[model samples]
Target: MDPDRVPRVRDMRVRVLRATTSSRARGPLLCIGTVALIIAVILGAWVRPAPGTTDTPAAKSHALSVAWPSQGQASALVEGLGDSGDLGNKGPQEPVPIASITKVMTAYVILRDHPLRAGQRGPGITIDRTAADESFSGVESSVPVREGQRLSERQVLELMLIPSGNNIARMLARWDAGSQEAFVRKMNRAARDLGMRHTVYTGASGLEETTVSTSSDQLKLARRVMRDATFRSIVAKPSTTVPGVPGTIRNTNTLLGTAGVIGLKTGSSTPAGGALMWAATAPDGNGNDRLILGVVLHQHADTNPRQGSQAALSNSRALIEAVREWLSTITSGTG
Candidate 1:
């Protein structure tokens, strides 16, 4: 074309051609945008998460199991008001000698006849010549009381349960039922009432071989006694002061400060061996109670009392750890 003269009329068609090309390019772009919108809608509708989804895991097979030692004539039991319960026992549930666990019964009877209210010091128990005689170490593990020193009933029960005071056991028996012989009769009757069929309480203290019980029977006694607020309160203390005494009487339970052990009793003798009626409790994350009530009876009976006590404590702690481990695995499992 001839420079400026021929192209004047053709310039408008060039503008139209440019406009057509732009419209043609927009068609593919609109199609691409529509496809992307459809894909996004499909993904939004189909790729959603399932209901109740979370990072937390779930539990499967709530049933729990444990393993324990086969030595000693002992039994370890853990039970609560929940689905979890466990036990580890060696030897038959046959009648075996129960040493100072007998004090649990003595406290039971005294509390049964004369209940100690929560935080109440209770009525005074005078330390007569007979009670004062408990200080004389005829048998091992005796706590002395002055002839005129007066203590509350709760304090006497504390002496009976904490330091394993044999004389206090006798004195409390006499005070409750008028005689140690009579109180023992009540003890047997109460055992029957509480369904401790395997137990017999011949003496106010577990010093006599005639006073015998099975581990299961002691567990039953523990369950019943743990329900009492007064007994529970007295046993939980690590140590307490007598009203007129200068020194504080400490609990003989070596496991008191650990394993969540609150209270119970310890028994040891040449006849009854080393026995411990123990109660353990711990709170879960939600603050629910988990109780492990058990009896380690006649542990290492042939061994000396010191060695037997160590064995009893070791066995009890092992059982507690086993329970905690089993619970951990169950709760942390993925369903």
Candidate 2:
């Protein structure tokens, strides 16, 4: 062969060998990379956190925190009183309107601000024309306060709460603070002081749409109210007749008849629907006292205040029973 041709042949062979080696090396690398990518995808799908989960430490801590009991869980604050199913099969924080239950707060605030002597009359309040016109006239469930009548602060409060009188709420709000707006502000401030963050007061009668509260907040308020001996007595009073009212007014709380039933409030409005706050005290197996504050809000069936209160009373009774049973079982080692 010629020298030039031989050199060219050698160069071509070298190039071919290099290309073969490169192909051989590239094949394994490509295969390995593909395998690695597939493994990564499979692992990612299998091991990843489910949706709505937070991977951060703080979120993880929150996830591990305790949660409220679900609806129908059998647990009682007091043992040996009744079973879990007795009061009502309901969650602790179900939102209900709590109708006249709002009065419990009004009474509490008044009592806190002014300490009245036992049998001492409340501050005298002249009935406003508006209050008188709207006062429980022809209302089956009101303590009648005449248009021109002058009523003691305590008397008006009793009428407001005991009979769930709308007029009394209005009158008291206007009487104590000079205006309903001022009284509402005081009520909201009091609620905030008690750590009822979810509560807002726009009306003394719970008639306004702006006046709102959650079940949890109301329960907290009820707990505080029940702690007061005087407040408890006032709420538990079955019947009280005012001197000026035409007919005797009875307490609207139906739980008064239930065993171990203490005192609480009930409320209802066109906007709020139906709501209730209640506390029950029952003896445990060892005769220890157990107290529970329950609240319910927004039942579909209770359109009227009267019907709503009835439903709440029935539901509360069932819940109390369920809680009692749960507690009894816990003490008996059968829970």
**TM-score list, all predictions:** 0.75, 0.67
- Candidate 1, lDDT over the whole model: 0.73
lDDT of 2 by residue, 198-220 (tens): 67777777655556666657666
lDDT of the candidates, in the order given? 0.73, 0.61
lDDT of 2 at 137: 66
- Which numbered prediction scores highest in lDDT against the true structure? 1
Regions of model 2 farther than 4 Å from truth: 1-98, 117-121, 136-142, 301-304, 328-335
Residues 1-335, model 1: lDDT tens digits: 22343354355445545555655667977656655555555455444433422211111123434334355455555465342353534456778788889989888888888987788879998887887876878756777889988888888888888888888888888888889999999999999999999888889978788899988778888889988999998888888877665588888787886877887788887666678888887654345556777787777786688777777777777766666555444331221
Clashes of 2: 36
Residue 50 accuracy (lDDT) in model 1: 36
